[model samples]
Target: MNLKNYPRPFYAINQFCQPQCTELAGRSFYFDMDGGYDYELKVLTGDTCEWNIAGEEPKKAVYECLKGDDTTYMFDFDIVGAEPRQNFFFCIDLEQSLVTLVRCYIGRNPKFPLLVASEYDFGAIRVEGQPLPKKRHCLTGEMMGTTVEWHWNITMFTQHNYYSPAYYRITWPQYSSAEGSISPNFEVLAASDEISQYVKIKDKMYLYCLTEEMMERELGDSSPFRSNNMIFLQNYDRMYHVGRTFGSIMMDGKVVPCRTMFGSFGNPVRLEYNWLTAENPFTV
Candidate 1:
């Protein structure tokens, strides 16, 4: 695909993503979240899943999963016909028997403008006759004030700047003088709309999440990202990431709740000035 001038704002990116993943199709797992909510999920082939919270009737919807290095998988799906639109994302580690769940919701209340707000929690995978892992993923600052260049697709390139403990910035790509127009895109994010969430699972393995709340508030239709949660688990040592994204996106011809997975590899980005360590530039 000639991905020139691909437009969807950065918020609803899907230009050069990996093919849909099916590694988790036909798999079933029960999750016991520490937050007291339990769920049973059955992933079917062909973009559909049947899942339910404990004691609730099963609901089916389209789903997507992306497999990453060393038995890590990312999957997401929405609750069809749900009020306010609730989408579920999972970062599962089969080797560790651990799981992380992110509940991304479309809170489009005019008063709140909650386009895509999420609540995160950690849990254990339930397997018959197997004990859950005693250890769980924890919050960390290992990637604080660092930068990595991620290639989302063939021609889509971007940078992730861990600008602050609470914020991360994305640098969009401009033309590369050396490669000319045939090359991909890469660069730093703007100073605004850097709010972020981070979690560490092991040495050099972490999770990063950011939403388009501020971007929609600032740029509306022009922002590269839209009302979605871009959540990914990155292994810095391996320079690879698997992510689950969910929100309303323009499909066919209309906007609908969507879930998807993507995988990519990246390397440490060399920067002249570190956003994490540099003086506050956005402060007025």
Candidate 2:
């Protein structure tokens, strides 16, 4: 099936649990911010669906009677807490079919500091050839103090596709370790036309950085050098072999293998890769 057409922001049908049984399964969502404010919850569900928000006194019912095969629930609310505080939580009941949850945070003013948030899906059933969705979460600490109004949007969905390889380019500024100085790394700068393609299946997504060399190779230059700089990556799930390199090239005409470093300063060279397609094998 065309998994691309399925709901992507909420949950995909084949990538996560299938809605085939009657169970009170749900996910926990959390949002944290630095400013003090108030908020509200908005929920919509398919026919015969039920749900509730945590910490809401009187146990207010977000949705009780959903009517339809596909239902969408949206929660928009303010956050009221002291500086460096968190606020938000909810649970959903899916009897059949998949449920999509779209949660957004609207700050009361422009003073909301880095809004941190996350969501947990409770009692999710395991399926084959599919990966469990990544917990929806974000944490942007005090580095981004509350000064400007902002909105945080999180979406979850489920879907499935064949295993494919992808590529990525990580660029950093150039630095002089001996001199203890920093400068822009011209060699690692991306071209204006560089674009990235994301292959997403369910909660897993592989990001591919399309470089000029890769484009040239794909267009028909059967050169060994082109194959040496290409790599593939798998970015979702807990897989160690998420990426593979085509080796490395020398900055002054020598050849060397690429090494992974935690910091990105002084690195004059960047990496590239070849993403697998339905018609092409990763090794090619």
Task: Return the TM-score for candidate 1, rounded to 2 decimals.
Answer: 0.79
Best by lDDT: 1
Taking the tens digit of each residue's C-alpha lDDT, what string does model 1 give over 114-211?
47888889999988898877788876777786788877655556666786667776655464221332222212323444567888777778888877
- lDDT (C-alpha) at residue 207 in model 2: 22
lDDT of 2 by residue, 1-284 (tens): 89766666532111222123222225332222112221222332321222233345422232322111122221212233323322232212122112222222222224321222222222221233545333322211211111111011112211112222232222221221211111122222232122223322123222221223343234222222221221122222332112212223344444333311110001112222221122332133
Residue 57, candidate 1: alpha-carbon lDDT: 90
Which sections of candidate 2 miss by over 4 Å?
1-196, 207-241, 251-284
Candidate 2: residue 10 lDDT (0-100): 38
lDDT, candidates in the order shown: 0.70, 0.24
The lDDT, on a scale of 0 to 1, for candidate 2 is 0.24
